[model samples]
Target chain A: MKLPAKAAQPNSENLPFFEGAEKGDLVLPRCDDCDFVIWFPREICPECGSQKVSWFKASGKGSIYSSTVTRRIPGGWSKVTPFVLAYVELDEGPRVMTNIVECDPEHVSIGDRVEAVFEEATNRDGESGPPLLRFRVTES
Target chain B: MSIKGKAFIAGVYEHPERHLPDRTLPQIHADVALGALADAGLSTSDVDAYYSAGDAPGFGVLSMVDYLGLNCHYVNDTETGGSSYLVHAQHAAAAIAAGHIDVALITLAGKPRTGGDAPGGSGRAGGAPEAPFESQWGMSVPGGYALAAQRHMYEFGTTSEQLAEVKVAASTHAQHNPHAFLQDVVTVDEVLESPMISDPLHRLDCCVITDGGGAMVIVSESVANRLTRHAIPILGTGSFVKSSQSGRIDLSHTGAVRSGPLAFAEAGVTPNDIDYVSVYDSFTITVLITLEDLGFCERGTGGQFVASGALRAPHGELPFNTDGGGLCNNHPANRGGMTKVIEAVRQLRNEAHTEVQVPDCELAVAHGTGGSLATRSASSTMVLGRSL
Candidate 1:
C-alpha cells in the first residue's frame, strides 16, 4: 500500500523522536518529575511543567483504541486509497495516531494488537524521506 | 456579574447563496455584515467592536475591520476552528456586559467549496508539534470522526441505522427550507446506501461544503432595548477545548460534556428547559454524541434518543436544526457556528419557516464543535431566551 509523503519538518523539540525512527526504534519522552509519558514528543512536560524530560526506547507494542478505513483520500495522498488510520494505545500508556498496515484495511478492528513498523517514505522525485512510524497487526 | 440578560443578539443574517464563486471573500463578509446591521436597524457606524475567526481572509480581524470601514475600539480574532464564532459571541457579550463595547459585529466567510479545500485539509503550519507524529497517516476529516463513531458503536451498540436517523431528521427539516443545499427529504435507507466516505460515516453523514458566509450583531441591553427588532437575550455562554490528553484519549465524549453544564449553570436552566436546539451537524455522529454530552439524554443512549425522532422539528420533544443544520443546509466557509446562532435567533424571533417552527419557543441552545471529533476539538454552547 502507498503511504503519504513525509510532510513533517523536524524541529528542535521533535528531532529526537525522528532520530530514533532512523534507528528503527520507537522512542518516547517521559517526564522525570511527573513520570508522564509524552506523546508527540515535546520539550516540556504538560502535566508538571518540567523541562526535565528523558527519552527511552518503548516496547513498540500497542492496541488499537479506535480506527477508520478511509476510502476517500485527500490531496497528494489520493494514491494511498483504502488505508486504515487509527489511534494505538501504547503499552507504556500513551496513544499515538498511526496507520494500521500489512493487513486488509477492512479487517482491522478496535482493540487489535499492533506493533510499530517504520517504513521509508519516497516523494515523486524518488527522493527518500524520514522513516514513517506505522503499526501493523501482530499475530495472536 | 453574570452576562445573563446583560447582552442580547440584536440581529443575525445567513447568506442565501450556498455557492458564490463570483463573489470574493471580502464581498461576502461585507454582504453579511450589512445584512445583519440592517436587520438590527443599526448601521456600520454603530459597530464599535468587530469579531471574526480564522476564516476572515488576509490579516483576519484587521483586514475585515478596515475593509468594512468600522471604527472599532475592541477587536477579537480568537479562532477555535468552526466554533470560533460561538466563542466570539460569548466574548462579545462579556465585553458588552463590562461596558467596553455597545455594539459587536461577528462575521465569517470562506470560498472552500470553490477553492476545493475541505475544512481541516492539510493546512497545518509546518513544524507544528503534532505534525511529526500525526501527519504521516492519511487522516481525512471524516476519518477522524469515523474513529469516534467506531468506538461509540463498539461500546454503546450504536447502529448505522440509528446514526442515519440524524441525516433523516436533517433532510426532513431541509425540505421546508427553500435555500437549503439539499432540500429533498431522505430516508435512513438512503443514508445507508450512500457511499461510505469513512467507515461508519457515509457521504450523506457529512455536511455540505458551501462558499457563502454569515454574520451576527450582538448588542448591550440598552442598545438592544432601543432597537426595533426582537432582541434575543444572551442568557449564558460556555466553551471548552478537548484534546488527546497527551495520548490518553477517550472517544466516547466531547468537550460539550463540560461546556454544556457550564452554560446551563450560568443560564440557570436545565436541559429540559430548552425549547429548541441547533447542534452543529458536521456529521451524523457529531449530533448524536453532542446530544449526550449536552445532557439531552443519558450517555450511551443517544442512538435511541435520536432514532426516536427527537430531533424532528415542529413536534419532537426537542426540535433541532430547524434550518436543516449543516447536515443538509449550508455549512458556509466550513464553519457552522455562525449559522447555528442565526437559526437560534430565527427560532426565538418566530421567523423560522412555518413547517419547522417550534410553537412558543422561548429558550434555545446553539452549540458548535470545531476541529475534529476524535482529535483536538473545541465546543462552544450558548443559551438564548426571548426578550421579556
Candidate 2:
C-alpha cells in the first residue's frame, strides 16, 4: 500500500480504506507457492505458506447472507446510512461483509443473488484509482 | 480449562472518569474496582491479583497495585487489545486453577472515550510497527470487516434486514440496561437510512464510543465458596490462534470453529446444553461469523440461521447478548471483552434486570476478538454455568 496506485493505498494502510463505487475487482495479495488467489491478500499463502504474495483476482458472484441498513454515519462519512451492510459469501470461498449498491438499495432479499460490477471512481483520498467493487442484486 | 465449581461474577463496576478526577486512568479503574468489590461486599485488600488490557502511565504489573494500595500473588496486563480482559479472566482462572493467584481483579480504562487517543495506542499500544503488508496496503480495522462482510454477502443470501435484527435485538437489551449509552429504538428503516461509513456498512453498523472503565474479580474455588454460598465456576475456556491467514480458513468461520470443540470437550457439554449466550458483537459480521463458527449453524448457512426466528424465544431458544452487547451496549473498544464477560457473569448469577434478562438463567458463554479479520485476530471463548 506504500505509494500504492492510490486505490491500493487502503490495501496498504491496512485500515479505514475509503474507495469509490467502481473498484469491484476482487484483487488481493497472491501466493508464491502456487500463485493461487487469496482474499484479504497478505504476506503469505494460507495454502502453501509461501511468503511470496501478490494480488490476484477473485470470483465476484455469491449469495447474500445477512445485511444491516444503518441511518447514521459518524466521522463525517454520512449520506449513506440506513444503508445496507452485507455479508456475502464469494464464489471463491471467503464470506465478505460489504455494501450492495447500484439498483434500488431495497428489494435486496436474503438468498437474492448478486454479481460484482466494478464502478471506477476516485475515493475521498484523492486517488482516482481502481473501480470500487460494488455488488448488484442479480438472480435468485 | 476446567472449573470445579461455578464462578459467579460477584463484582461489576464502571468508572466514567478513570481518564482523569474528572480524568485519570487509575482513578477511573479504581471506581469500577471499588464498585464491583462493593457490590460483592469485598474489600480492596481482599483482592489477590489484577488483570486488564491496554497500557496506563505505570510500567509495572498491576501498575496501580501500590497506587490502589493492594498486593497479591499474580497479575495480568497483557494488552491483547480488545479481548485482553477476557483473556485475562481466562488466564486468571487458569492461574487460580494452577494455584498461582486468588481473588484476581481484571479491569480496563482508557481515554479514547473522551475523543482523544493516548500516545502509541493503536490497539497494538505502539507494539512493533504492524506487519509491512497491512501497513503498506493501507487496510484498516473496519475495512477488513468490510472486505469480509462483502465476501459474506457474496457467498450467502444474507440481507440488510437480517443484520438489522441484530442491532434491534441488542438495542432492546440496551433499553433494559440503565448503563447502556445508546438505547434508541431505531427501526430497520432508520438503520438502513444511516450514512455509509464504508460501503455495505452504515454508521449504525459500527459500535458507539463512550468514555468509561470496567473491572471484574475472579477467585479460587475455595476462596469463592467461602466468600459466597453460590459461585459460577468457569467450566472451560479456550484460546485459538490460526496464527497466520494462509488460505485454509474462510472469513465466515472463526477460531471458535476449532476452539468451540476444544472448549466443549473440556467442559463436557454441547451447544444445546447451554441456556443463554453473551456473544461479542464488534460489528454485525463478528456475530454472523461466530454464530456459524461456534456450531450454532452449519457453515454457509449462518445468514439463514440468524434471521430464522430461532434466535427469538418462547421458542425457548438460547438468548444472546442479553445486555445489548458491543453493538447496542458498552463498546469502550478496549473493554469490549470485559463487557461481554461481565454480562455473561450477571446472567449466570441471575443478576440482569428487566428490559433484558433471563429468568433463573444458569449457563452462558462469552467470545472476544482482538485483531481485524485480515490478520491474526485472537479468538477466546469461556463457557460459564452456575454452581449448584
Candidate 3:
C-alpha cells in the first residue's frame, strides 16, 4: 500500500537529485557534450565519457516501461504487502525505478502514463529525510 | 589463438548436502576442491592456478588458496554474482590457452540455508551510485525478474501457463536427482496455484536456496592426457556485462545476446548442435528470456519452445539441466553458476543419472546470469564437447 520507510542516503554525485526531490521537483543529470540523460545520477556520462554533466528540472511525466506487484515484501515489510514497483520511461528518455502509488496495484500496467509525486519518509534515526519519488497513473 | 580445445574440464564435483550447518565455509570449499581433485586423479600439489568469485570466504582467492594450501602461479577472483564461476571457467580457459597456467581449480561454496540471509539481502551501503535511486523501493529478487516477465507478456503475448512449463520440466527432471532440493514433479496448474511472490512469477518459478557448493578442475591438453578421468574439452567461452545503459534498459532481453553468439561463433557450432544445455534458472522467466537471447528460437517464441517440453531431459529436442538446475536442484550460497558448470560436465562425461542423461551427448552449453535481469547483469556462456 506504501513505499518502504527507508530513506535515500545521498552522496556528492546524487545529492542534487535528492535535494530536488525535497523541493517537489524531478531533476536529472544530462550530459552537456552528448546530450545523454544519465539515470542513477553519476559524475561522468556513460556514453561520451564526458565529465561535463549538469542537472535540470525534468517534465516529471512518463509512461510505465514495466511494472510488478510485489506480494512478498522482504526485510519484514509484509504489512505493506502487494505494492506496485515499476520503471517509468520519462519523456526525457530516462527510466527510473519507483513505486506506482494512488491506484490499485493490480490496475498498473505497462505503458500507462504516470506523473511523479514525492512522499516524505523517516530514516532509522527518526529524522525526516528527503522525499522519495513515486509515480501515479494520470490521464493521457 | 582461441581457447577452443586448449583446456579440458578434467574433474567436477557438486556438494551433495543441501544443508550443512556443521561445516564451515572454508571447509565446504576444501571439500569440493578435494572432491574434484580426486575425481581428476590429481593431488592438491598439481594445481597451479586458482579461480573463485565473491562467494569465496574471507579474503576471497587469497583466503581459499592459502586455506587449501594451493601454491598457485596465477589466480583470479572475478565477481559476477551468480555467474562468477562460469566467468572463471572462461578466464581459466583463456589463461591455459595463453600458456600462463595449467591445472586451474575453481570452487564455490555458500551456506544460505543454514547461514541465514542470502547474500545481498541488505541493501547496498554507503555511496553505491544506484542504491539511492532504487534501493528504497520494495525490489525483491523476484520483483526484478517479474518486471521483465511483465514486459515480455505485454509485448509478446507470453502467458503465465507458458512460464509454468519451465518449472514443470525442471520438477520432472528433479524427480530423478536424489540431491535435488525439490524432487516432486509439478504441473502447470500447480505452478499457477502457488502463491505469487511477485506478479507474473509464482513461488514455484523461483529456485531453491541451499547450503552447498561445487568445484571444477580445468587443465591443459597435456594435463588432461595424463588424467585417468574422462576430460570434457572447453570448446568456446564468452562473457559479457549488460547494464541499464543509463535508463535505456530493455527488460525483454539479457546479456546472452552478445555472449551466446560470440561463444557459438568461436565454437563453430550452432544451437542445433547442442545435445544438452545447463541454463541458470534463477527463475522461470530467466530461462525464457535467456533461451531467446541465446538464439535457441525466435525472440518471442521462447514461450512456445519451452511449453513444448524442449527443456525436459532424456527425450526433449534439447535436454537441459539434467541435474535439476538451480530451479529444483540446488542454488548453493544463493549462487547457481557453479552447479550449472558441474552439471554440464556430468552430461559431457555421460555421468548424469541414467533417467535424465542425454544419450551420446557430445556437445553442451553451460550458461550463467549474475546480478538481476531488470537491472545491471552479467552473462557467461561456455560450449563444451566430449573428448575424443
Candidate 4:
C-alpha cells in the first residue's frame, strides 16, 4: 500500500502538531510553562504535563542505538524488504529513527557515528513530498 | 499485605480443533472458552464476567452463553488493539482486586482480517488531511522504519551482518517449534544477499501472515480456589502508549520504555531477574530495539548484545523465542501479541520442548507492540513468576 499522506504537507501552519524538516533544523516541542525539549512533540510535556508547547529546530546528529532488517516487508511493498531500520540517538540529546541511505548496509553497526542530511525524493514533475531526512556516516 | 503477591490466571487456551477455516469469529470464541474453562475446571455457570476485544458485535457472554449453555452476570468488549487483550488481563486483575467480579474471562479474537490495504493507508489518511510529510511521497511503516535502519547504519556503524545474525538465530529457534510457519534456517548470506526492500529493512526482516485465536480466563483468588488446582500467577504487569502514529521520533525506545519499567517496579524485579522471555519480534529490529529499550544493555549497544557470544545456546544468559517469534512463527494478524503470552505461559508450565526449552524455569516476561510507531502504540509487559 502507498505510505500515509499526512506527512506530505509543506506548510506546518495551523496544523495540530507537525513541521517539515528544514536544513540545519531539528524540530522539537518547547514547553511554554518552562522551556524544555520534548522529542515526541506534544501540546504538553509527558514529563510536567503542560498544555502549551512550541516547535523549534536544532542540530540533527546522533549515534546508532540499534537496528533491524525487515525481510517480510510491509503491505503492498514486497519489493522493499531486506532493509535496515534503526534508532539513532541524536546528539541534540533526542533520538530520531530514520532511513540510512547511500551506504553499504553491511557497513552499519551499533555505536557507529552518523550525521543527518536532508534529501527530497521527488515523484517526477518536480512535485515532491515532504523533505525526507536521512543519515550518513560521520567522519569520526 | 503486599499488593505484589501472586495472582492466578485461572484459564487459558487456543482454538480446539487447530485449523478451522470455516469457523466464524464467534465460533472460535466458543471453542477457546470451552478449552480455557476445562483448564480452569470451571464451567460458564461459574463465570461472573467475560471480556472481549475485537472489531465485532454481540460480544460479552450474550453471544457466547448459547455455546456454553449458561449465562453470566457481567460481560465486556473492551478493544485495545491486538495488545488490548493482554491489557484486558491486567484490567481484569484490577477488577478482581476491587471485587468487581469473582472470575473474569478475558478473551481476544479477530474475524480474520482478510488482506487488502493497510488501515488509514493506501495513499494516506489525508481526511483531505493526510499528515502531509509522508503522503505527498510514499512512506509506509516499512519506509518509516527504513529511515531508522539507515540512520543506525550511518551513526553507530551497524552492519547488515549484525541484523542477519538476529534473523538467523530466530530462524534456528523457530525450526524447533512445530507451530512456526516458515522453516529452513535462513543464513546471514541469504539475508544480506537478498534484495533491499527499504534500504535497511530487507524482506526477511519483516513479519508474516497467518490466522490465529487466543483466550484467557482470570479469576479472583477466591473464585480460583473453587476453579482448578493448577494456576499460573500473574506476579506483575504494566502497559503504556508513547506515540500513536502522531509524529516522527525515536524509532527505538517504544512505549515499552515506560511499561517495561513499570512492570519491573511492580514486580520488584529487573531484566536480570527474568528467567525466560517471550519478546515480541514483529521484525528482527524490534528485538534489537527492545534489548536496549528494556535495559538489557546500554543504548546503541544492542547490536553488540546480540553479537555477544554469551547469549549463544548452551551458555547464554537468556534464551529467547522458544516458540519462534513472529519472524519465524505464525503471525496471524493480532496473533503477534498473543504469541508472547502463550509462550510465556507454556514455558512457565514446563511446556516448551526441543531446541529453545529452558531446563526448569520460573519467572518469565512476555511483551508485545500494537499500533504504529509514528503515532500511538500500546506496549504491555507481563511478569509471570511461577508459584507451582
Candidate 5:
C-alpha cells in the first residue's frame, strides 16, 4: 500500500524495528537492566537509562488500548477514509500506534483483541519501501 | 519560601481583533505587548524582565525583544506548548518574589490563520520528538485527543452527549460575547449532529482557529500596590510536562492531577472555593479531563458533573469559560492560556460583560493543556484572587 515518504524512511535508531517487520516479526527493544520492552526502538532504555538493549520478537498479540475513527484525513495519509487508528497494548507490555485493517472503523472497540500484521510499504511515488506494521481484529 | 501572593497581574489585554490576516507576526506581538503595558498604566521603560515562548513570532524571545525595542535585564523564553505563558507567570512570580526582578511582561502572539504556520499538530522537532514508529500511522490532532476520550468512555461510561454538554455551555456563554468568533447559540443536539473529526469529538468539540495575540504585565506586590489599576493577586501556580513514553500515561488522568493540588494548596483553597474557572478547551475532552484532574469532581464522574449543566448560564454552580472560551470564542493560535488568564482576571475584577459575569468572583482558576493527549503533553494551572 502507498505510504508517505516519511512513513517509508526509518531513522538510524529505529532501523532494526523496520528490519524485523520485513522478516514478518514484530521485534521490540528489551532492556537487560530493567526488563522493560521499549517500542519505537530507542538505543537506551527509557525506564532505566541502560545501554544494554537488544531486540526480541514480541508475541504479536495485543488488545486495543484506545482508538479513534479518523473522518478527517490530512494530506499525505494515503487517502484512507474513516479508518481506525489505535494504540495496541502488546502482550510484551508496550503500546504501538497502528491502523486497524480488515474491519470497519466503527466496529473496533477498546479492549478488543488484535494481532500484528505487516504490509508492503510504498513511497508516495509508489516506489517499494520498508514493510509497514498494522493490526487486525482477531476472530473471537 | 512560597511565592504565594508575591506577584500580582497589573494589566492584561486580548487583542480585540483576533483575525489579523494582513498583520505580520512581529506586529501582533508588538501591539499586544504595548497594549498590555498601556493597560497597566506603565511603559516598556518600567519592565525589568520579559517572558515568552522561544518559538514565538519573529523567532525566539530575543527577536521579539528586538522587535518590541525593549531593554530588559532578564528574559525567559520557555516553550511548553500552549500553556507556556501560564508557566511564564509562575516563573515570573518566583523571580519577582526572590528579588530577581520587579516587573515582568509575558507575551504570546502567533498568526495561525494568516501566517501559514498554525500552532497545533505533530510534525515539529525538538522538545519531545514524535515517535518514529508512530509517525507512520498518520495521526491528526483531534485523533490524538480522541484516544483519551475513547478511553475515558471505556473506563467510566462517559457518553458522547455528556461531552456535548461542554460545547453547549461554552456556546451559551459565547452568545453573550461580542468578540467571540462564534455567537450563535448551539445546543447539545446540534453539537452531536455536527461533523465528526474523530469518533467522539465533533467539529464543535474543537476550538476555533484564529490568528491573534495576548499580553499580561506581572509585577511585584510592591509595584502592584502603587499601580492605579486594581491588582489581581497571583495566589498559586503549578505545571507539569510528560513525554510520550509508553507505560507512563494514564489516559484517564493528566498532568493536572499533580499540578492542580499544588496550586490549590498554595492558594489555601480547595476546588469548592473557586468562583469561576477558565480551564482550556482545545477540545471537549480537554475540559473534561482538566475538570476531573483539577478536583472539580471525582475522577470518573466528569460526565455526570458536566451533564448537570452546572457549568452553564447565570446560575451555574461553578461558572467556567464565561468569555466563550476557546471552543466558540477566539483561539489565538496555540496561546489559548493567555486568553484563559485574561478571562479569570476579568471575572475576578467584576469587569466581565454583564451576561457571563460571576457575581463577586473572588477566586478563579486558569488552566491550559498543550501538545496531544495519547502522547507527550504539558499542563499549567494558575490560581488568581481579587486583592482584598
Candidate 6:
C-alpha cells in the first residue's frame, strides 16, 4: 500500500512491525520477563522495564475497543473523508491503530468484531511502500 | 513540601483585540505586559524574574528581554503546550517561596487568526518518542478526543444532547462578555446542528480559533502586602503529565482525577466550596470529562450534571468559564492556560465584568488540559482565593 508521505517512518523500535505489515502479518513485541505484549513497539517493556523482549506474529482477529469517524483530512488523507479510525484490540492482547474498512464508518462501533487485512496505497509522490494494515467487521 | 498560598497574582491583563492582524506576536506581548504592570501598580524595575513558553513573533526570552528592555535575574521557557502557563504558575509560586525571586512575570501571546500559523493540534508528533503505532494510523487531535467521547457514550449512555449542553452553557456566558469572540447565544440544537469535525463532535462542540493573549504578575506575599491592587492568592496548585499514546489508558478518566484532588487537598477545600470555575474547553468533551474527574460529580454522570444548564453563567449552579471559555470567548491562539488563570483571578477579586461576575466568589478553580486525548493528557489544576 502507498502510505501517506507524512506517515511515520519505521525505526529500530518499530521496524519489525512495519516489516510485518509489508509481509501481510501482524507482528508485535512481547516482554520475555512478564509475557506482556506491547503496542507502539518499544525496546523495553513498560510493565517490567525488561530489555529482554522478542517479536512474534499473532492472530489478526480482534474487537474494536474504540472508534471514530474522522471527517477532517489533512494533506495526504484528503481522499478518505469520514473514515473509520479505530483502536482494535487483538485477541492476543494490545490495541492497534488501524482503519475499519469495507463497512460504513457510521455503522462501526465499540465491541464490534473485526479482523486485519492488508492493502497497498501509493502516496501523491507515486511511492509505493509497505502494505498498510486495515480492519473490517467480521460478524457481518 | 506544599507551596500553597505563598504567592499572589497582583496584576493581570489581556490584549484587548481578539484578532489583531496589524499587530505582531511580540507587540501583543509587550502591550499586555505593560498593561499588567500598570494594573499591579508597579514598573519594569520591580520585576526580578520572567517566565514564558514557545516564542513571540520569531524570538525567545533573549530578544523579548532586549525588545521590552526587561532586566531580570531568573528566566524560564518551560513549554508544555497549552497547559504550560498553569505549570509555570505552579513553578513560580514555588520559586518565590524558596526565595529565588520576588516579583515574577508570566506572559502568553499569539496571533493564531492573523499570523497564519496558529498553535493547536494533536498532543505530540507520532513515532519514536511517542506511540509510533497510533501516529502511523493518521490520528488527528480531534480524532483522539473522539475516541474518548465514543467510550463515554457507550459506557454511560451519554447522548450528543448532553455534550451540546456544554457548548450552550459556554455560549450563554459569552453573550454577557463583550470581549468574547463569539457572543451570540446558541442553543443545544444549534450546537448539534453544526458541522461534524469528528464523530460525535460537531463544529460548536469544539473551541474557536482566534488571535489573542493574556499576562499575569505574581509576587511574594511580602511584595503583595505593599501593593495597592487586590492580590489574588494562589491557594493551591497541582499538575500531572500522562501520555495517552503508549500507555493503556481507560480513555474515560484522565489525569484530572489525580491532579484535581491534589489542588483541593492543598487548598483545604472541597469541590462544593468552589464558587467559580475556569476549565480549558479545547472541546466540549474536555469540560464534561474534567468536571467528572475533578470530583464535582461521580464518574460517567458528567453529561447529566451539565445538562440542567448548571454550568451557565449569570446565575448557574456553578459559574464555569465566566469568560465564555475557549468555546465562545477565546483560546489565545496556541496557549489556553493563561486565559483560564486570568478569569479565575478576575472572579476571585470581584473584578470580572458585572454581567458574568459570581457574587462574592471567594474561591475558584482553574484547570487546563494539554496534548492529545488519545495519549494521556497533561492536566494542571489550580485553586485560587481572595485571601489566605
Question: Taking the tens digit of each residue's C-alpha lDDT, what string does model 1 give over B1-388?
Answer: 8999999899899999998889988999999999999999999999999999878777888998999999999999987888999999999999999999999999988888787356884233455567677767878888889999999999999999999999999999999999999999999999999998989999999999888899999999889878889989999999999987877889999999999998999999999999999998999999999999999999999999999999999999899999999999999988899999999999999999999999999999999999888778999999999864
Give each model a TM-score: 0.98, 0.74, 0.98, 0.73, 0.96, 0.94
DockQ of 5: 0.63
Against the reference, the lDDT scores of all candidates come to 0.90, 0.64, 0.90, 0.63, 0.84, 0.82
What lDDT, from 0 to 1, does candidate 4 have? 0.63
lDDT of 2: 0.64
Stretches > 4 Å off in candidate 4: A1-140, B1-3, B16-21, B54-80, B111-137, B227-229, B244-248, B309-315
Q: State the lDDT at B82 in candidate 2.
A: 69
Show where candidate 6 strays beyond 4 Å.
Answer: A1-7, A74-76, A121-125, B55-59, B118-128
Candidate 6 achieves a global lDDT of 0.82
Native contacts retained per candidate? Answer: 0.90, 0.10, 0.90, 0.21, 0.69, 0.57
The residue-by-residue lDDT of candidate 4 on B1-388, one tens digit each, is: 2225435786677542334467676666676777778888887787777776553335344666555565566666654455666777777777777777777776544434443223322222234332432233234555555555655556666677787777777787778766677777888889888676666767787666555566777877777666545677787788887753333355546788888888888888899888787777766677777777777777787788776632333236776776667777766434466667777787777777646667667788888766655445678888876772
Which run of 10 residues does model 6 chain A get worst, by summed lDDT?
A: A1-10
lDDT of 1 by residue, A1-140 (tens): 76765735667888888888889999999999999999768988877889999999999999999989888866866777788989999999998889988899878999899999999876457777668889999952
Name the regions of candidate 3 deviating beyond 4 angstroms: B116-126
By DockQ, the best candidate is 3
| All models, RMSD in angstroms | 1.4, 6.8, 1.4, 6.1, 2.0, 2.4
> DockQ of all candidates, in order?
0.80, 0.11, 0.86, 0.18, 0.63, 0.58
* Candidate 4 residue-wise lDDT, A49-133, digit = tens: 7878877666677777655454554444345444445556667665555555556656676677888766654544556544556
lDDT of 3 by residue, B1-388 (tens): 9999999999899999999999998899999999999999898999999998877766888998899999999999888889989999999999999998889999988888786447543212255568778788878899999999999999999999999999999998899999999999999999999999999999999999899899999999999888789999999988899998778899999999999999998999999899999998999999999999999989999999998989888999878888888889999888889898889998988889999999999999999999998889999999999963
Candidate 6 residue-wise lDDT, B189-283, digit = tens: 99888888788898888888778788899999899999999999888898998765344567887788888999999999999999999988988
The worst-scoring run of ten residues by lDDT in candidate 1 chain B lies at: B121-130
lDDT score, candidate 4, position A80: 46
